[model samples]
Target chain A: MTDTIAIGTADRKDAKTGTVAANRALAGPRVNGKAVVMTLYLVFLMLPIYWLVNMSLKTNTEITSGLTLWPRQITFDNYIRIFTDQSWYSGYINSLTYVVINTVLSISFALPAAYAFSRYRFLGDKHLFFWLLTNRMAPPAVFALPFFNLYSAIGLFDTPWAVALAHCLFNIPLAVWILEGFMSGVPREIDETAAIDGYSFPRFFVKIFMPLIASGIGVAAFFCFMFSWVELLLARTLTTVNAKPIAATMTRTISASGMDWGMLAAAGVLTIVPGALVIWFVRNYIAKGFALGRV
Target chain B: MTKTLNNKAWFLVLPVFAIVAFSAVLPLMTVVNYSVQDTFGNNQFFWNGIGWFQELLDPSKELGGRFFEALWRTLLFSAIILAIEIPLGILVALSMPREGWTVALCLVLMALPLLIPWNVVGTIWQVFARGDIGLLGWVVNHLGIDYNYTGDALDAWATIIVMDVWHWTSLVALLCYAGLKSIPDAYYQAARIDGASRWAVFRTIQLPKMRRVLLIAVLLRFMDSFMIYTEPFVLTGGGPGNATTFLSIDLVKLALGQFDLGKAAALSLVYNLIILAICWVFYTVMTNVDADRERVEA
Candidate 1:
């Protein structure tokens, strides 16, 4: 099912130059309209983020006293406090730890499965594929209490591994789905040629096949990272303090002093930084990855 | 390309199967177990045998009424967001610059919201839509509109909807953009020679090509919005008398907040089944579409 979609994207890349030229001519008259649309959309997209950033730079008094487009009396105290505070800084480390663990676990497990799905049709392959997808659709809420109980029972609760494994419920399926698409795009002839060259399956898979789908792996890992990082419910429910994610920490910003608007804004801004960095690295694959490689 | 039939392939699939099952199946079994049994304090339990389900399905009952209201509200929210985001996303994708540094710029900026933690998305909106400190709220109020999401249910709903749109429209746009990029120049050139109007070109060429991605975008947006919790939870904490309490939020409140294990489990099962049924429909449609395209190509 995914192979057809993969073929479409592989073909599209080859035909991209011609399409770009055609689009330029076709877009000539509508440039102004397109610009206006893009500007408005981008502005809408950025405004809230800009507000968060704006608030982060202001002192708590300045933030609550009035609305300002830009910080009136800029203060780095919020950022400094977060950096200095152990609880705040540890959240980032914990989030990154589990995200990395989840990404690695998901991609590694998914690679073999994706290769299997792409290369051969076995008994229940179609059923297996569909079943995997249903996991992706399972609401985290439905799993939250059960997960908390299950994880705690197994002594895996409040650890990075718990969240990493919990995330596999969705991320593994996603990785497999995406990697299968990319693998299917590579012809079976490569496998035949490698076999004829006296290469063993594992060796060829590691030495040749891995390089071929490097970007696919990257894309899959990127998604795993994104989902695991952004997800809070299971992560929060599963962990108490040690493995608490930065996102979960941000949710607990209300203090004895009341709403710490400046610190909260600063924390919010910090959370976005890691995601932005990850997105920048995967910007080229962002669109294709969003499509799950179906494009 | 035909795949060789090989049962050895199961070995390759074993790791994923083990990990996923450990995570998915075990918790699922617990949910199922809880749904069927009545629970008391100290982990003592009794067999309830569909009693909870019965109560859940009947609207006259308190649990049932809350369940149905939240369900309908969730469905409505999903519908509204999909209606707004899909067309808007397509337009943005269409309006996207063909080739330049600007394309990357737009793609990056557009995707920024998607990467933000769901809670922070709520926080950003919470701050951004506040009457006192939020730019959006202050502007709207100054424009002579009484806008306060914290107080008014309608305002809460609008804020949640708009926050959703802001957070997710980019995913749809990016998916559509990728789909649009896949259309070969030949299609557009052919349309030009045929003197196709822009709308006609979109309808005949772009829209047809985009069908697969659009299906995906719709499916994703529907599922995510239907299961929305953290954003609304942070923004209004289900807000001003349960106005924004979607199913996930309600379930969390019931399960974790109230510790109503039997009821929450039943609710969870029903909620999950609903998502599964919808997802199954989409999967069937998607596979059929793929099959039809393959047949056409052949």
Candidate 2:
């Protein structure tokens, strides 16, 4: 759609113009049915997340005792265990390692490819672009076995890099798509002017073009990090001992005795923290990216 | 909008191609190799060309029946989720406060579910929907619903669907909100000047503007619902006896659980082809719409 392309142009125009009247028109206080609907929806969204946090603070005995809206006795043991224990905390480090690698790899590789897609036509360009997207549509479950066999044969098995590389199959295409939207918005005249001013391609891209699309890169990176961070199946299958993710480790609580309800809830809460932090940082960019129809 | 014909751009795309090929192409080729063959351990494969594919396609056969059942279940799930979530998301987005701290708060809270690791989302709901300890299960039972998700098939389906709506409805809402925000106030003013009713304004201006983002929302929700695995896997483990077994879960059962590599490989190719075909249709429609817009603008 034209809706997608039109929004892209409209985004750049709005950013440059800073339409104050439009902002003022959309802003106001509402004390109507709409507010009630929004409030009820927020409650629905918050309750489950709140329940997870509530359970994390209770002892296993207390959790099994009965249904309580809030914990009667708040405890820090679950948090303390995660901090003190090597296995618990190492899971976070392992997850972070691959996620960071995947995000960096996806964005860096995607940058040049996105630039190509936005600016030029090469052999099989359209087909190649579509093929890239098709890879994103592949279910990770289907590829789990083959990825295991393929990575192990290459001797990259059980490593963070393997998960990172595997995640790139999806992330790269998405990064290219989002970044290309932003890149296309930058006037080609900027590139020509930079060239005429004696700047080389790399320098121009780094100093001029990159900054122009900094928010776009931020949005792309946010997506890559989120997808890689939350992914469980591929990460779990690819890495065994040294590079196990926290999501996988959380499942270990399902042992012979029973599930560790308290600790599992605690681990679940901890997994949310990094993502919350990232969203906090990228909050502005997400809205802008959405406006551009790039995400 | 014409692109410069520069073959040198291939150099720029080489890194992405190389990495994706290593991960996607080689593994995919392995799947293709396994699809047409017959294997019985010892790493020895037979030249049983098209045998597994035949078994998978013949509905009278066990494999074929299971595949169709799972496919149908997956399609039905996607349809139900889309029908509920899209309209609900639009309604929520319309109601969202447009200014002040409420905007930031809403954005963050709405994003919380999306950020939680998928399995943890299942875990949270698994705990939240428990008959013994969960608030929901306790309340529902007291209300005389006799709702036991672990025992009953309908309850299990309802739980998974509700859980998915809880998890992903925010995505549709956020995208629609973004689309709504992109519409200029001038449109509203013009509608107002014409004495347009609230419903008329929404129908004429808002719905039209939201179309592209809704398309994105539909495509995403469809593909994700089709390949849904983790949340349902954690919640039900694909049962109260295959009741909630969608395509991705079934494929995992065949590939990983049974280790029937040949049949699993054949199933995977079929599963992937369906996704490919549907996504291709979405892509072509989207591009054609884009092309039409460009023509009008020119």
The candidate maximizing DockQ is 1
Candidate 1: which pairs clash? none
- Model 2 chain B poorest ten-residue lDDT run: B189-198
- Listed per prediction, chain B TM-scores read 0.98, 0.98
Candidate DockQ scores, in order: 0.47, 0.42
Error of 1 at A33 (Å): 0.4
- What clash count does candidate 2 reach? 0
Model 2 TM-score is: 0.94
**Candidate that scores best on TM-score:** 1
* lDDT of candidate 2 over A153-241, digit per residue (tens): 99999999999999998999989988998898888999999999999999999999999999899989999999899889899999999
Interface RMSD of 1: 4.5
User: What does candidate 2's lDDT look like per residue over B33-140, in tens digits?
Assistant: 988888788899898788999999999999999999999999999999999999999999998886888898888888878888899999989989998888788889
